[model samples]
Target: MAFHTRSNSFPSMPHPIVQEVDEHLCRLRSSEAASTSSSSICHKLSGLQDLHDCVDKLLLLPLTQQALAKEQNKKWTNELLDGSLRLLDVCSSAKDAILQTKECFGGIHRRKSLPISLLVEE
Candidate 1:
């Protein structure tokens, strides 16, 4: 399946850093899926690293009272919702990558399967 791209619904532009990080993640995942051997696992690891960077950048965005007030006044942007959905898609892709890696490594124990929560935190 193709990965879903982030929606551009918000009136305000997304923090440029967010776009860069997301693009990096998408590229990493796509490349990994086309590769063989440990390279795919390495790509997934790189994607996680990029995700961490994105989180850090997101935290640095202005969350001051004035900014929050303005944000509250504006209607929920489509871009914001789209970003969230895109992140969810990334999470799913990451989980699949991990599972495939584990299976490739023969770590799958038929008697004790890992819980879904292991892939997605509740």
Candidate 2:
């Protein structure tokens, strides 16, 4: 990446790609700030648990009403009665990804401790 100027704003127009990237970076920084606000992994996992509870509550709602709540996929006709099940699917995928990452790092920590064990044996 190349830094073109002090700012991306132009008199008549803006650089769309740069603007999008900057917005994404800002969001990332905000999320980083939020995640770093709590140092405990347990806290974050508890948050995930809370999300799961919300999902369970959501499950109590009728499928048609649930689909109607999601505006992005709502159609003009009978489909308006339908709910986008994608929300649960996406959330579950994200949860899986987070757990996978935790497992990967846990394995890495165990691997790092192997040398310490070898040192102790020596």
Candidate 3:
């Protein structure tokens, strides 16, 4: 099933970076049903990476910089910053966990491929 895209609903959000991020999010959501496979996980991770790249590009825009500077002290701004920090922390932790799991699995595969004699030697 196809997921609804929110970009059209947000006509005021004309920036290309915002649109790119929205597209990535929509694609990720639409593919959620097939998320059982490693390839699907990789696709979702790539989408998230694209979203982060879009966010970095958005931050580089002069308009974005000015708006952030203009409202840096507002409550909403503070909340946004706090939320972004939390997201960053969660992403970092997730990356670490994924790496650890991958390493563990790699070791398992390596052990499984070893000759029986080599296994006994270990």
Candidate 4:
């Protein structure tokens, strides 16, 4: 039997598909940014043991949510929520790390600024 391949005449990225793809890329970028920020904060705050634990907890948030959403068969919502939660968790972990580092080194809370509130509101 001969294998057949489809013709390469498909239309270049349909408008809706392009939009969806763009949105997903943006989400992935945002998630990456958050993860980087959290890791940086953790590195800076390596002196604080509690902050390390907090960061670990936050890192698990997205994984937990994704698993639950998949079990519930909420594919679209799960994807969106997983992205959002990952971002939120990373930001939160970073903030906690920064705060703990400041507290250990300076004896006071120094919160790191982040845009997490906007996502929480949604």
Q: Which candidate achieves the best lDDT against the true structure?
A: 3
Candidate 4, after superposition: displacement of residue 18 in Å?
10
Q: Candidate 2: which pairs clash?
A: 67-82, 67-83
Question: Which of the two, 3 or 4, has more lDDT?
Answer: 3
Model 4 lDDT, full chain set: 0.55
Tens digits of per-residue lDDT for model 3 on 33-101? 875655666667777778777877987889777777785557766886787788689778767877887
Candidate 3 global CA lDDT score: 0.77
Models 1 onward score TM values of 0.38, 0.35, 0.68, 0.30
lDDT of 4 by residue, 1-122 (tens): 99989888765864443454455555444554454464654643342333344434543566545765575656766675676677668767877877786677563222224455644554
- Better structure of 1 and 3 per TM-score: 3
Residues 10-62, model 2: lDDT tens digits:
44754444454455545444555464422344455455455445444444556
| TM-score, model 4 to reference | 0.30
Error of 3 at 85 (Å): 2.0
Off by over 4 Å in 4: 1-74, 108-122
Which portions of model 1 miss their true places by more than 4 Å?
1-38, 63-78, 104-122
Best-to-worst order by lDDT is 3, 1, 4, 2
Full-model lDDT for every candidate: 0.67, 0.54, 0.77, 0.55
> In candidate 2, how many Å is residue 43 off?
7.1
Off by more than 4 A, model 2: 1-33, 36-83, 116-122
